[model samples]
Target chain A: MGTRKIVIEPVTRVEGHGKVTILLDEAGQVSQARLHIVEFRGFERFIQGRPYWEIPVLVQRLCGICPVSHHLAAAKAMDGIVGVDRLTPTAEKMRRLMHYGQMFQSHALHFFHLVSPDLLFGFDADPLERNVIGVARKYPELAVQGVMMRKYGQEIIKATAGKKIHGTGAIPGGINKNLSIAERDGFLKEIDQMLAWCRTSLTIARDYTLEHLDELADFGSFDSNHVSLVRADGAMDLYHGNLRAIDKDGNRIFDQVDYQGYFKYIAEEVKPWSYMKFPFISSLGPETGWYRVGPLARINACDFIDTPEAEVARKDFLSVTDGQPNNITMAYHWARMVELLHAGEKIRELLHDPDLQGGDLVLKGERRGESVGLIEAPRGTLFHHYKVDENDQVTMANLIVSTTNNNTPMNRAVEGVARKYLSGAEITEGLLNRVEVAIRAYDPCLSCATHAMGRMPLVVELHDAAGRTLDRRVRD
Target chain B: MSDSVTITIDGRNIEARPGQTILEAADAAGIYIPRLCSHPDLKPIGSCRVCTVVVDGRPQAACVKPVMDGMVVQNSTPELLQHRRNIVDMMFVEGNHFCMFCEKSGNCELQAMAYRFGITAPQYPFQFPEKEVDASHPDILLDHNRCIMCARCVRASQELDGKNVFQSIGRGFARKIGVNGERALGDTDMAATDKAADICPVGCIVRKRVGFEKPIGQRLYDTRPIGSDIEEVRA
Candidate 1:
């Protein structure tokens, strides 16, 4: 059967500027599904040869949403070469606390603000209901829960880092602020309310899933290698750790890999079709090697969660599908809520640490050298690596962002899911939207993709070796 | 074989080694000090009064306070703490800081130090400074309301970029961190990878432009202390 071109430009709800295109054969099989991550932001190249201490500030600019994570990761990356001797214990706790706040707020933003519109209202709901305002109309309570959860997260950040966005204080040397007793008291008051809201929201999301159980599961089932943040002790850690990538066979393909290792295992091949590079893991070829991130990877990577509440929720999560690596991409929403629960409870634990009381804020004693920082961004694993020479100047920098982490697999998964669901030539909006939803589920930050802005109409027209336009579509 | 320096902190005869600032000496002497612009990672910009100490009958910022042989550094003095408290007062009023409505209330350095110094009310009339907030980027945020005018962010932009993407727009209290000609960050050539946002000590400068991506609990600073055992920098 000859192929029939089907187009869905301007991918919706995801961060940054991007578009996707899918091509189906006359047999109605998805012949080519491409996620054209069309943002060319060269943050790494621009950050070269600056003061090592300034990296946290500079790299944080790469993506505004996860700057707290990037800032910490940048600081840690510098610490990998330099040191954090200038920081005090209290400052450390404050930074961790602020990071948790970002995680909570960021995940909430992705789940509730960005993607929940699709989950709460059916994917094929009226376009008006496909937006956040629609969620407020259809389910006012859930919308409120989202606002409260996200607001509390931002509140925590403001309290610790002094700003809701691009906050400072958490760094290689130390943190800037100590949690005040009043701040502690306020957080305590807000925690329970937010947790209750999280529960209600998650339930609603679960209910939505239960309603579409068949569609959700059968919609997306592409498989690939997965990667994420792990503690040196191999624990589930979003901030401060080396990285690990596992193949679909449940075998460890790469362990404790440094940023340089990323260069070896992952390759970024630029296609003229889009500004973003198609990231592929070397062990797996472009087509077969699909990967995933966000809720799916977080649940898969950790042996267990740290919070008791989250642990219980995890079991409930597993029970929904017998818990053996549920690949339902729609589950990203429920998984996101589970992670939010863990964050809320985790905040309480961090707040109570006695050492969190007053201590030296800035060590001001010495500047550090080179280091690599890692954190699990809302999308996947985000890495910031910096090389600073003496004179406190940055000599080199490398950033493996969350979207980049999920690139190879994202492309494959899009095609796999699209093909499986689009087998019938009916071309319902539900089928097309689900394919895009799979990529958005990871919440990829394309602003940090390849660091460039190419001309409009970037399309990877798959031509057979003979150079025939087997498929042609634009990603603009 | 280091030069010995003597200074009196809160009536204690403390002998500080050479190259130790009065702030360092006072801190070594266990003085309760407050600060905003003096980061160990960067050069000292004694803008915040939290670390003000009395030395030789004049108040001095402890972070920038240099060590002198046979010098007297008075920390925790009623007069000095008052001055520090006074500075915090000005900061609280200069910005449109509504503690209850703010996201940084409990953890704000400005709030913590104010409470620490027992500064209850805004001694000075509120500036109620009103400026347009720049939310151009998705992850980072720029709130003009909470700025304390320390210029640390300016220093960061200038010192880091050497491109001078940021500068103080006006003189004195009216001075604000801004791009040249008052341009927004996104409007400039300054790369998003620039960490200029890291130098801000208050909620004024933020990364609000980034969008939804990171999961809820997996954030970097949420569960652990960033400065506890700075040795964890090894992590």
Candidate 2:
């Protein structure tokens, strides 16, 4: 018997970077698989010597694409560093509005623009029908709604923060933006419409995806720990709390711990083949230290969502698995929509609060010490730890980003997805592309996590049983 | 310190009292608008069109738009939005925004808005202007080529510390923010203190300090934006 060949070209529709390779056994049972991200940018080392307050400002520079998440997470960590735990009700409400705004734009983008292209347009659709343009052609309304949803969320971010992509909405200790009666009322009015639109669109999506379980079910499945932020009271927290982790059995491992406290349970180590460092719980730190974060992680850790609408969506989400293990690989879409609905309901609640109209914008202050901050970025738990000396000079800095939270688990999940999707196939481009897309389901933005660049190889080859090379090729 | 006042925007009488901008009122009101120059932390420069609104029938920067009673503000008027579109076009023309070639393409604000407003082609001829990028800073970069003159870099410099390192060199058709006194950014007394590079609406200003430290797909906002986590900071 001779060796078989496989090929996948210019993987379609998504952002940033990824690559995957699979090896076969003699009897065709999967022997091994490699997922390599062949580039690196050192952000952990870059944040040194800045003012403690600048963690949110500086680490935010990591990724322009998702600066808000970095900014917020960094702000949270900075607060931890400074040790300012209590927040005024008004301040808390305003900050909630800003965060919800971020969720709206980001979740909408992921569901409609990034992953929806595959599900809505059909993975096998013509290349023309498989992108943003394709969505515009087939479902102009959806495309338009997606754009509007994203735009509205971004607008909220800009209003509350400073700009759209990377705003300074969340500052250590408290928020910087305030609300007026007029501003609050307008957002409230918009929320009704926005929520209605979102519910309609996402419900349509959930239905569409449900109807086509073949693709969803067949794409991939993997088991891993779900790591996230938990409130001081131990409930799952999307923002404003401590780190939490749950294993495959839904067992809580780390709950409501401080940002710096993460060192006790978590560990980071570099692998030679990739720029991204693999991070996992020290408890799970042997060779089997597979852990996950982001959409999969959030869903895994939560018992119930805080908002009413999201809880309803959760029921639908849970029904799919019937309280069974949620494959880490498939949790991407469910996580996105659940957060979207939560964002809508939460923002609506914030906008309706009477205190949103109160006066108390900027808190006049001159800080004299260090601060740390933490928050759940779209991907997973994120931390910004800074140490400022007496002169307000930064002596040390550290940032643990969302992707970093999933670094170890991502490698494992990718292998699972790749093996399941590509192990048996003749290694067609479709299977390869799907494997890559599965990684993107997390929508990783390393830029905000640290700082990074893109480097990938497109190589495919066939070898005979005796090890004589049949063919090999590398792409530009 | 009871700092408070009553102000109205676009016929909506709201009390801003103190420490808030017209943009805050407008945003809370859920109005469709545009802006690029105004940021929450940075002073309002009114450089971009994304937050433009007509105050008392006079076109003004909504981000900095002050609220006054009986003030009739029109945010969605066709004229103002068209002007915003023109400003966006200037951003497109003034910079090398070939989204296909740039790493920041997919998540770029200018690119996203262009898509939102349906400005596919640069109505004006591409300037392809050759602007200098200062890579002196270890953690960031200033790519002049991608700057749309939103003046954000200028504000981050001026307001942040009264460091006027960036100034408009040319007038009208050739207006650009050059280094102060014809000096490179390194000689402008600019420390990492000047965060203008990160705030640039376009790709012109880049962070060289931590270049490509995090790979794509691992970024935070790429998944959930800052708005969703605003309360996290406050709480």
For residue A340, model 1's alpha carbon misses the true position, in angstroms, by 0.6
RMSD of 1: 15.7
Residues A386-417, model 2: lDDT tens digits: 67654334567666677766655555655676
- Give the poorly placed runs of model 1, Cα more than 4 Å off: A1-4, A26-29, A85-87, A256-269, A280-290, A320-323, A362-369, A421-428, A452-476, B1-235
Give the CA lDDT, 0 to 100, for residue A408 in model 2. Answer: 58
Cα lDDT tens digits, model 1, A324-397, are: 55567677777877887777777888888876778676554444455666677667777666766554446777
The superposed Cα distance between candidate 1 and the true structure at residue A274, in angstroms, equals: 3.5
DockQ of each: 0.02, 0.03
Cα lDDT tens digits, model 2, B30-69, are 4334555666778776656568777766777777766654
Task: Please identify model 2 stretches exceeding 4 Å from their true place.
Answer: A1-12, A24-30, A81-83, A361-371, A449-476, B1-235
What is model 1's DockQ versus the real complex?
A: 0.02
The sequence of per-residue lDDT tens digits that candidate 1 reaches over residues B72-164 is 767766777677778788788878775543334444567666666667788799877666555544345566777777777777777775667
